[model samples]
Target: MKKIIFIICPFIGLYWLMSSCEDFLEVEAPNHIITSEVVFNNDETAIGALNGIYNQLYTSAFSSGWQDSVTALAGLSSDILEVIRSTNITLKEYDQNEINPNNTRNFNIWSSGYNIIYMTNSLLEGLANSNNVTDETRNRLEGEAKFIRAFTYFNLVNLYDDIPLLTSKDYRSNALAARNSSEEVYELIIRDLENSINLLGESYLDGERTRINNYTSMALLARVYLYRENWGYAESLSEKVIAQSGIYELLENLDEVFLANSKEAIWQISPAGRGTITSHTNEGSIFIINPIFASLSHFKLSTGFVNSFQEEDKRFQDWIRFHSGLSVYYPYKYKIRNSTESITEYSMVLRLAEQYLIRAEARVMQDNLIGAIDDIDKIRSRAGLELLAETNPGISKEALRETIMEERKRELFTEWGHRWMDLKRTGRAAELLGANNSLWQDTDILYPIPEEERMKNPNLTQNAGY
Candidate 1:
């Protein structure tokens, strides 16, 4: 796979606006201000800049084309079923025992994730030394930069355990840098986000929720902490975002959340103007079943994942749809594919519903039983179902944990690469995936650093068990 090139812009100079009094005539707007504060400053510039950030993630080499590859990865990890299960997919599966670091699946994710890291670092440096920038405005942008930086690092550390800790804009092979362990990489991710929470703003979709803000940072922090086993902080951060929520909410009609008309999103790449509508559909709908990948005809839900959902739950109504034979039991989360010209279609990244799940899981780990159940009830309540009553009083803590995991699966199916990651973290890879994969053991939790990177830089090395 070809490396996905990312355009990184650096901050140049400071823009100083001269001001006066009386008639307000002596003040002149420096052209530099336009570059820094006008085009790159203000709320709208932040939105446009973040738009580019979202575009980077949506690329096929990045997220869109990644679904199939993750299916393959999950096959290795045991999260998905082979679209063709007849002859014996389990017999010829490509587990890490047969993995080539140069394969399209591993390499594309590496390239795409690094590009995101590059863009985040560039933005952070620019914001730090920025001039003529209002403290309030600068704080918000810095908070945003920190959030993106943390997100990139979190994904990097999650997927690849040992990676070059490039906190600055260093791209040269000869540059002095060494691969950082997964624990260390996670530390940097945590520090950047902890600082961002105090600086970001609370944006609404009706307002400017498209850009990364305080709530978005908090959301990422919640997920990151959950990954790192810092349940206390994860629960705290997610609760803060959820409790302070105003515009963000769970769509009463679960189906609308993934549609263009979604009102529950806290952050989304608001689709506007026009862009390519793939055979997978476009506009606001995400097509899970299509003719392009006709092997999808035999798509089946994981029995565990299917049984996790409650009967009459609205999430099933919105996400799970079945028409007829051939291709049925299809996920209709993104059903807004349009012909002619694609107009507005929002790509959901962060939504309030997710915060509730995060809060629930983190609270469960924190041993806040009532709190965890409350959070879960919030999600269930939004689905038009009653809360966990006194008679049932919710499930056991361990059962609740599993239930939350399933709810997250049901809620976040086919969005970002959550399904695959969850399977690995939950230790279900070997069970659901069948046999043949020896690397799904404790050490094979993360992807090895690509051989191309190792060959290019002596400082970089592969992860353990590679």
Candidate 2:
């Protein structure tokens, strides 16, 4: 086996120094490249390697929640967001679902996701070969690395149906790797999450919710099962996470949900990970329209989407903001646009609200109508809407399922491409988006595998209708 060489950079280790987390900051200066042998020789450096992955997530184009991130790109691909500037050809492709194989932004989303996967693979190999680290440290690092890998693969598979599943850091082999079936990719995702759950402890390491824990793995795994339509496991896993009310809960005030370390967050990526003076999350910086710079803003909530919300829905009132100057409503889930103060909001990846919706859908699929309504009402109640149980206790299973889908759209919009992925997974992308988008095609559900990637590797093939 070949040793993985890591180019340790300032941003990778700067996360600890900036956050003042002493335990993971004792490594050497972050300027020089170091081999895996030295990185995994001690506890702190090995941990720093894992920390680097988390930090890079804030910088990675795919997960950063910025204009290039999934939240913005996929929101445009879906109906939730509209491109404020039609001149941006890259974004227009996503908005119209006519993305060219040569589009660089589409390639960026694809390559950036694989970059994180590479880091995770590197960390996993280093941890496996090292005997200098303690068992406790090794297990925790392994679990976190696997969880991140699984998370990245999940997004990639959804975006490009059959993707190159690179599990190891063998560049020679990986450079020429062919795309694997979605089933093959998902098999690895499920296996990784299950192993991660067993390897990790119940509590967040060092009391930081940003760190992956047993429940974090379970939360993601539950979602994976739900997407695969494994209803029993999805319901059971989500039920377990929801039961941990002491650690996680739905905040009564919707405004507090995205705050750093909020009880609502199951897992989050801190803006501190960017290692920049501008502490505001990318989501806020891109989506929130500043009057002075209103002309520069790129995206706004779609008019149809804004109208989809009921008049009394608190999410509509609390999470959406209107700009009279621009005459458009924008997503305000993350409030601070330009701030140099201490970090206040961490980008929400998984939360308690999604679990409730997941369980509701799973239950309805299992024909537990009454139980399903109870779960849906939890989200509806938080939004200050009439409880479904009271308003439509006798609703049929089909109607209840549609209600859950609508609720997910309203609740999870503009967050991690949930709306786009939901439409694809539920087989409704063509039916829903086609009605409005003239460019809609069933093949558009999967982005064209980047043309540049195919050029580099002859084995890599393009998706149909590209």
TM-score of each: 0.77, 0.94
Off by over 4 Å in 2: 1-6, 9-33
Q: For candidate 1, give the lDDT.
A: 0.59
**CA-lDDT, candidates in order:** 0.59, 0.87
Candidate 1 per-residue lDDT, tens place, 1-466, comes to 2222223233322211111011011222222323333445544454455556555555524343233334334433334332334443431233333455665556655655665665566556656655645677667667776777777667666667667677765444313357777778888888888788788656643465556667777888888877767888888888787776455667676656755535577666544312354422331232355446545443444445556677878777777665444434555666654444543346666778888888888888877878888888887777767677453475789988877886777777655557667766666655644354444455555666667655555666667667
> Model 2, 263-380: lDDT tens per residue?
9999999998887788998898899997697988899889999999999999999999999988999999998998999999999999999999999999999999999999999999
Best by lDDT: 2
Task: Find the 10 residues in a row with the least total lDDT in model 2.
Answer: 16-25
**Top candidate when judged by TM-score against the true structure:** 2
